[model samples]
Target: MVAQRSPVDLTDRRALLARQPDDPTVLAEAQRLKEVALLDFGIRDSVVASWLYTKCHHHIPTTAVETAAVVATGDGSCLLLYNPQFFVDIGLAGVRFVLFHEARHLMHRHLYAEQELRADPLFHLAAEVSINHVAMVRLQVTGLPSRVVPGKDAGTSHEPVGVDPREVHQRYADDLRDQGREPLSYEEFVDTDLVVYRELKRMRTPLVMPVGLCIHADHVGRHGSEFPADAETVGLIIGEALAEAIRAALRGNRLARDEVLNLIDRSEGGGDRLTRMWGNLGAAALRGETPRTRRVDWWKRWLADTLASKLREGERLVYPKKQGAVLLALGHDPMLSRRGRERTKVVLIALDTSGSMPDEVVDWVTTLVGQTDGVESHWLSFDGVVMPFVPGERVYGGGGTNFQNVVDYAEGRLAIDGVPFEVQPDAVIMVTDGYAPHVTPAQPDRWIWLITNGGDDWPEHHHPPMACHRVTTGDR
Candidate 1:
């Protein structure tokens, strides 16, 4: 029989940590165990695990933690804490499982940094389930040692630890069947973190999370106010790390390549947010597709094609007497002039500026228009009235939206700040949320409407509809 350990005193954990450094041998053992865990990560070909482990500060803090836990430092690094005595009890395989488990928690936090999602208790349980499932499969562990019991022969039974995702899924499946509903397979049940949470919520009585199982439960609060640092930047860092791992794996590292490929397969089509996040990581290898195919943002491409068609040169060409030498050399007459052929297309870009447009969308539009050659760009930031401003200039707006004012300005029917748009524009592009009154433009064909996500798409359904496309601002 295994000897039962005394209840851990949470209050004295700090005092124990304060005296931890005094024990050199215990600290050395902890370091060795960490190295062994890294080796296991290598064996499993987990690039994310290896990268995350490198960024973590391993400490054998004499805390009451039964096994191990990882905590984000809010500065793009994490702390990996373990009890040295616990390592001796559970042995090497258990230590490897715990370390991998902790690393995955950090990745989960980085990937799904939304405050609302992280706050949901069901979501937290789902994350635990997903991480544990992946760890078990990758590490080839049928079970983990129990922390509640400890002795010379403790944890040798190989019984699974904590809340098993498969068992919970099975319980959910059984309940759904009783209700005459279909249950997801074990593979589908553990697809993504949110999928698990959403499916579990459908249950009449969702599984409750047992206490003292998840170590970082307290860290995720209702508002995520605990983590004040920029979560997006941290997420970007994690993405870059994944990209490097993928590249390393591609360079003949079989283990890393297989592990990352599995992660990619499991996380495919998670949602637009996840897609955008992974897109930035140069994750072509993950998708098993080329970069060209992935860069195809439908709306952006449509907008580009529309602009190209609108600004296309007229059939008429003027021959310049002085610059016709090149044309003459090509067996063409000197009558071919470059002056009229190179017609500068006039484009007026109007922003709604109702404090509803995303800054990222604005930046993307500005960059797109600024880079095009042979186009005269005119920028207008409008709320109730139109304000003509140069590109890259900041325009503050908090007033009501008025579509008529923008149309009037673009049509040369109005002037602002002694700047009159006397020249007829070849194309007028409007970026808005479609929350204002509908006004017909003088030339609706030349007008292109790019509506932001969640905006009213009135133009799309309008009688004699205008060119319109929804800009998918994924996760921005």
Candidate 2:
């Protein structure tokens, strides 16, 4: 874990960065790690033409992961240079935090939205002080799918982040070609109600609303997730408004001020915890003891314990399981085709028919069919003969087992069925007692050989990109 730091500003990075490291060796390692992170996220930063994005066809200069700051290209498609050394020196979690922070920039569409909102909404509320939380929330929700790059079939471009900040500058100039507009200063961004409401200034009294909110059914299926940051930002503003409204109601004799405060405190719990506090604040207000105005400190506590909790629970309504990348690809195209189109996915799982195998493995292999789990597992269990593992259009029943027939069957089907339909097999996971062939894929690009070494006849080539592993039926 990394020590949490104060909020940061990357734009004036020079002032933000206290010192710089100059070791060339450190810079090299930083660059390598940055490349791995980029690939893990599915970002392609190459000079080759993909027949995909036209703007990405040109040369992409080597990205420097060590610079505190660097240059950008004109088209917004190249990294040009960076100082990865700053990130490495900070430690990995620090790097992860920084990467996560930078990811928000790419995911939120902040560049474009900031330009539009600054030019429009800030004028509506004169002298506004923060980034427009309401607009930011709306944009993030609208753009979630667009930014995440669910899969190749999602049709979203896997563009490099900040190919060039200079392009951002150029875009700004182009957008301002009509000189009639004005950009809001950064001061207007940080001080606005967006920030103040979040921290709470108690311009009014707090409410007695319930501590808990209901969650959607779909949300329960996915993990309990926090609300989107932008949405949390909006919630703070609204919560502050609600607090002020409650104070108004009490002062106007709608309710006893102490009774309301008691209700709020009681909301922390119910039965006995709430029995005593209702007459405190409300009674004082009735006797004209104190005027209602914003109390920044009271709000700070309320916001963190109350409204802030709501913000964290925002995505409880999102239903992440249904919203993930798997379904996105299944529901769309280019990545999958039933008949014959572009690329086809063929799934083959190897089963060890060895004497050491257990019954549970057989049960699992049998039930997961019809491609419900997004795969048609071709299972081959080898005792001596190459018994058919995963029966395809070619067979209906499970038979004997043979180690060598596993590859033979796959190559045959791929050459036959795939050739006729013009599709290709992308993945093949072999779940077996590692007694099979020691041969590697001549066409290594199409296969992922995972040797589930049940009986310990270990195979050698199980390292990476091409994954190899052993799994017992007892251990998941």
**RMSD versus native structure for model 1:** 19.5
Listed in order, each prediction's TM-score against the native is 0.52, 0.28
The superposed Cα distance between candidate 1 and the true structure at residue 144, in angstroms, equals 3.3
Per-residue error for 78 in candidate 2, Å, reads 25
Judge candidate 2 against the unseen true structure and give its global Cα lDDT, from 0 to 1.
Answer: 0.32
Report the lDDT tens digits of candidate 1 across residue range 1-476. 11223234322335436645456786766766666566556445366776665544334466445566654445555455677866655567777777777677666663345778765777778888888888888888776545435453764443445678888899999989988899999998998777888899989887877665655654332243342224554465456457556655644577777777777777777666666655554355345653333444556655765676467434212235455567568874333212235578888999988867777777877787777777898888999889888876888687999999988888778878777789888889899998999988878878889998888888877866887888883332
**What pairs collide in candidate 1?**
45-255, 319-336, 319-337, 320-337
Each model's RMSD to truth, in Å?
19.5, 25.6
Question: Which 10-residue window in model 2 sums to the lowest lDDT?
Answer: 213-222
Report the Cα lDDT for residue 187, model 2: 36
Residue 154 in model 2: lDDT: 65
* lDDT of each residue in 382-422, candidate 2, tens digit only: 44444443453232223444555556555664233233213
